[model samples]
Target: MEHFALAKEFPPASEADWRAIVDKALKGAPFRVLENQLYEGFATSPLYTGAATSPARHGQRGWLIVQPVAGASLADAERQLADDLANGATALSLDLNNGPAIRKAAELKAVAGAGVPVFLAPGSSPADAALLLAKADKTIVGTAGFDPLTVFAMSGEVPADRKAALADTVDAALAIRERFPLVTPFLASSRAWNGAGGSAVDELALTLAAAVAYWRALEAAGLSREDASRAIGFKLCASADLFLTIASFRAIRLLWARAHEAAGIASNEHILLYAKMPPRILSAYDPQVNMLRATASVFGAAIGGATAIEVYPFDEAATEPTPLSRRIARNTGLVLQSEAWLSAVADPAAGSAYVETLTEKLAASAWALFREVEAKGGLLKALESGFVAERLRQTAEKRERAIAHRKERITGVSVFPNLNEKIALEEPAAIIMEEAHPTVDFALPAPGAGERFAALISAAARGVPLAELHSASRIVCDIIAGGALDVARRDAEPFEVLRQRADFALASIGSRPPVFLALLGSPSDYRARSLWVQSFFAAGGIEAVLPEEGFTDVEKLAAAFKQSPAPIACLCSSNSAYGELKGAAAALKRAGASHVYLAGPASLLASLDPNDQTAVDRLIYEGCNALAVLEEAQRILRVEELAEAAGLEAEDENFGAFDEA
Candidate 1:
């Protein structure tokens, strides 16, 4: 075989060469334009020249495809579970909060028989854990899902008897370990923080803090450091940001290892990382785009070395998951694994300078935040003092502002929206109620039962209902100062509200709130701004009535606007055209335009209306507060009021000096 060195044929490109090329492409723009500053307090460089000498690896070949099943009844759950298992899901997550009420030992055993691992999401109650273990197959490896700290953070309440509840959880975990060694009893999850719009740093810090709290609790209960570490697993949300998600997962592993090392534990055990797709990024407008998001999330999770991955159904935001949606969600992981071979390598992102650097930065930031949480006396105390809530709020507000200004564009919501998109959603499955049965009288466990798990499991085997089981371990804590971490919000929620208002107006009247594009000169002169203005308004569900042809005369454009039903008008044209037709805004205002908007920046306003500042009521340009502008337009057009007073004209009150034109 002939040997050829490609490196010798092509000289190594220096950083100067790259900068020269980039500078040419950027024209006069600064090189910093290519860099991006993340919410985690780090900037991403445009290029990386050095290679990482050593990088962490996932140390595993593939991840478990965990399918989360939530149904109205046990039968429904069984059906979905069977279908998911058959279609390549390697594990199952029972959404106890919304899924079937698995009360009896028989029900738990039946659902657990899929021959794959079962992760109890949000964790099972102490009593529920007992019931799960009473009939669960010992060979099945999974988690008991007893995560009280996360539950407290999410609900903004601590158990009135916090110590007893936590002690009971520890006892339940110990029992699960004795019966099923492969099953992890505790879960440290950051879904609450992630769902609350926390940054990757927030999620990592919170998870580490919560896990430390659990480790201390477990250790105090006579478990060794290694035992406590082994008994718990981690669950983190994998978002659409691919590189960030990868770095986040990798960073957590490093942090966990560091935490164990600090505790003087020399265990080489890998952390069980379960990466779940977050609902915060899911959009109901264009639900199909969620599939792409899910794919990206799965890729990130797999590359970053998740032990298990769960892909949320695309239409879950709009309605319950239909069978088709469930299959698509399940297949998303299967295709990536089987065809894309995403999981063929351990820590696929390892050795990439960008990923390694990001991982190190994220780990450092998260560790610092974790220490801050510790200074507040741990995750629970931080939540109690509203420290966690405040931090999450700050990040959430920053992210919201970015989305509102269109700085962070959301497809189909803030960017290219489809106003006329008839979303094809399958009708939600009808809830099947279980037939009422005679209530069974079962003696409740004492307030401080010695072995709560044993007592609960014995009671469960006697057919006691889940309600009675939960009543014995119910958490009744005080709500934090602010309500539960601001309810999970999507990036598209604000714009979606605007669309909803538009939909209501359309149903009440015959059309959506309209904005007329008062185009000037030839199509080439105004086409760019015309289209930009149209898409901008359409994002808010406001219909843009574009002129059939650009007009050179201001009177003709104003006459066309007067015939249209739009109460608001935006002048769209090139700077030269705006300078040529300086009377367009005045003419449109005289023709009954309630408000006039210029499509370009404030600089173009002087060309359109040099004498009167109010001639152009507002300017719509890139980086402007788009949501605020659309909302102001809605208020001016009275879209909400139009719903009640359909066909009634809103009197123009802001005609200004142009009224005499």
Candidate 2:
């Protein structure tokens, strides 16, 4: 069969024609209702036509499947690494913080053998990493010592001797570079910035600023511009939102080109872009759904042209990931690469009108913000001045507000929650929590500018500890904030708190918080609202007990309500049925319901008897505050007091902490 040029078979429709049809269908609703405003202060159109012009791909199409390896001991870690490597992982990223210490250089060697890239978290012993890679052949090691500024921003305390730490880090990088050409010992990670509630543009800006600051430091230490650029790498957080994640990755590349051009360096080499899933979006209550979240992140990163990607295990929020969870995460990447054929297309998002437009806007906004940070004396100075912290705090507050009001939905958490679902978590043998170091938030004055790269490298080569390379500071500026910046949080946090209360009720009292559904009229008339009411209650971990059958007789409905284990009842029905529900609502209140909620449009309840509070206490409908509604449900169910006590014990400080990749 020959191609018939099918598009020409129909006449093209104009924008005006489409608008007329939409407006007529909308029945007097405004056209602006279709516009979706993003947190970035921009609106996304509902439709697109021709493709927008996109930048050329400066990197490879394929991404490394960076898997996390952790265990109780070095031997355990080594075995875990071996299993992952043999299964399907292309690279390994270790979380040595919580696991047993890697006390010997041989341990690192045993975990990562040869021809694979290994990324270690910041504060990991660079000396050990250098020693291990010294004997390995073509193994790429990513060291985090070079990026102490991130640690400073996160912990709100600078190192005792800032200049010495900087010099030591540069020296470690120089030593590693000399011994193992594949090792990139310097990193500018945006993990802390993004995880601390910064937007995509803010994260990109801060990352670029940090990269620029490091480049200058490296150059001052005697490395050539090309070498300095090559020695530094980036780690950014990937979100579940598809277009934002894709545009964010692309924006960073464009920003990188501009950084090199501004520095008068003409290099065409692609910089390392490691994409890690943002822990802010993961939920502990519905860990299985986290798999879908991770998949979305990986898909976005792969399409956005990441050099490497790491997908956190779904059970990371609850406990150590079981072997099954680990394999699921690793194979998620494999299936995307081989079966989905993602690697075959370079810049998969390129030329997409929506993506290209978003990328250009993101780059422009990020560049402007980066310039602002630079103007505030670069990333370090801005952080010290509390500018960075203030901006992030404001954004976090706004996001939390949106979540509380139900403007932003977290599925299986804030919406359609399964209160009866059993959570599966592999209990760790021991959870080693890191103790906070006692320190003041004072900045030290530089005693000396710092040693040159050669001297530092020579010192490192002689087995000098990186921390002992410099002199103590003479100047102390007490500019540090009182506590660490708040961790990136999810919209489901408030609702999850409710679930905790329900769990407490079940464990302590042998029952879940219960809410009775007083569904009225025929199945077809009230079934949808009945299910809606059920889901709404479930979000608060409250068991919504519905009648076995819809009732026409008000006495039967009242009788069923009297038998319910809950003191709270919600009436679910159509507008016509609700108009006749005043008597039924009064009967439920008489049946011992402490509170009666009508689940429908608020307009339906506005005409009901205002004098009779017993008939209806409030309205439960879309756009109402979910947190408030759930709290009320808890109060009526008598679980509020129990929940309050349980919340304190259930707090997981590791909420948004991600496994280093």
Candidate 3:
């Protein structure tokens, strides 16, 4: 009887109510419910499924959640490392750049400890990784920038002939065999290709090309095949495309092992794969979406059989990852590993028909690309001819065009749009870096054109990397060799212009008092506050347009909505008018006004009230609170664009105009 009674009294559903129901389904406990259902858990792929591989070797224990800590100042960077460690971050990855950089591993070493694994990115010299390793207790798990492809990639200064001389730059890429044997050379990173605009297939091919270039260079430099095999490493980007990412990584091991075997240096050992989310795809709008994206990326990496993963904060592209964002990003992996027990199952995707089919396709396509790179004289040669970079540019253009057309939408970003997004990106805590926070830093001085002497002092005193000034062209350089046909061009995209125009107009989500007049008792109440309030709100640009009969609830008010739509409908009547109005007021405003409130004697109205005021989801009394909320909703609902989409005006003569806030 109680349940039945409550059902009759229950309030109508609100947006919040719907959200609660959906959220329960999204993160439902027990993962799989017999009554409800199960969203498949994240899974990975393995190379050998049916065939025998020596007993499952205790493949590397836990891998690092390495977050690159290279920042501006030594003090700031040190603080950054401490903060990263405090969060679930397991290690540090340094980014070494030439031209005014600190390279003070010894000085920064004071901040890191024996517990954290410190590694350097591939572009850094082995000496830098060695320096970091010397300071930290863990072995540096990094690669050398010594392959011919690397030389060609960084060939801004080196001559074509002499570029080969930098071969010993990172000890021919094989020095890891003697000292840091577990170090990765190019066994799993394809960032160079992926970041530039290369497709998933292109990434694998280019990495293979780079690997071949490394093998040739290392062999020429007098290294054994085994050493060369142990020296290379690979870095790849994980994305929301889970199947693609898993297929990509699983294919890397299979293909790389095949490449090594073909080169007469096959090893049963698995290649180290460090997967990170691509910064290029990260967006500043609806920054919270970054968290969801990163979570998906982590899932992809875990199931893709990545040896390690670096889940950068969603804000990585927009700004530095804050302690809170970093903690969340890091724990994302920890949660998957511990509570989710993802690591318990290896190559969970191995047997799936789709994954196996995708993996084989990727491998075949990558091998084809690898052969093409060789035909073009290898990765470095492709770089010299701008082949690879040009190819990447074209792909980047295609992606941009897709976004413009809305064929591929980035929610809360390029789509599901919100303009004038005020994103807050906290600067990394001072750990001992080179420069202050971007929000605090002043104007960038003229590149190379600025005073050289003064620049040296500012850079030295501040930790400004000089390369930042010289690389301005990289920004405008159409990564696509040929200018891509701008898919986002004006004629090509109409919504782009519309979206931009509406964006030029701002929204006032702020609160304001409603326009209302005091209701006079009895008949004077007929010319009551409701009449004045409706006029005042409309005149003041509030959405609510109450009518004389707007006071009634449901069944009656349905007729009012049939007349013309208004943002809200206020009820105006005297205490004695209650019996004639109360139930009607509740019925009319039902499923109608964005908000509704009342005026007059509360006690008198209560006596005549036949239906629950709470039924329609709200009951505003004669006060500022209800009025303020109503005004705010009117501003947000924004129903004034009555005929634009219908094109009562333009009809293809011209595009419509955006609403002015």
Best by lDDT: 1
Worst 10 residues of 2 by lDDT: 652-661
Q: Local error of candidate 1 at 456, Å?
A: 1.4
Look at candidate 2 and give me any clashing residue pairs: 445-475
Candidate 3 lDDT trough over 10 residues, lowest sum: 652-661
- Which RMSD values do the candidates have, in order? 4.0, 6.7, 16.2
The TM-score ranking, best first, is 1, 2, 3
lDDT-wise, the better of 2 and 3 is 2
Ranking by lDDT: 1, 2, 3
lDDT of 3 at 646: 37
Give lDDT per model, in order. Answer: 0.81, 0.72, 0.52
Residue 106, model 1: Cα distance from true site in angstroms? 2.7
Error of 3 at 380 (Å): 1.0
Please give, for residues 1-661, the per-residue lDDT of candidate 3 as tens digits.
5556655677787656775776687686542332311011122322213422323222433456776674556676667677777766776665655211454445645433536554556555433443444443325444433333443353332333434333433342433455445455444356656655567887788887877677666666667777666667677878767778877877777777888778876664656677888765566545678788787887777777876788767666446656677778778788877788778777776666666767777888788878888899776556656677666666666655554434455665434444335444344444433433233233433222113222323332343332332221121211323322221121112232333222222222222222222122345555655543443333223333344533334454556543433334455566565556546545545544444455544564455565635533333443323224433544444423421223233222112121121
Worst 10 residues of 1 by lDDT: 652-661
lDDT of 2 by residue, 448-545 (tens): 22223334334434444323322211223233655567664555668887887787756655567677787788898898888888888888888877
Q: Number of the top candidate by TM-score? A: 1
After TM-score superposition, what is the CA distance of residue 239 in candidate 1 from its true location, in Å?
0.5
- TM-score winner between candidates 1 and 2: 1
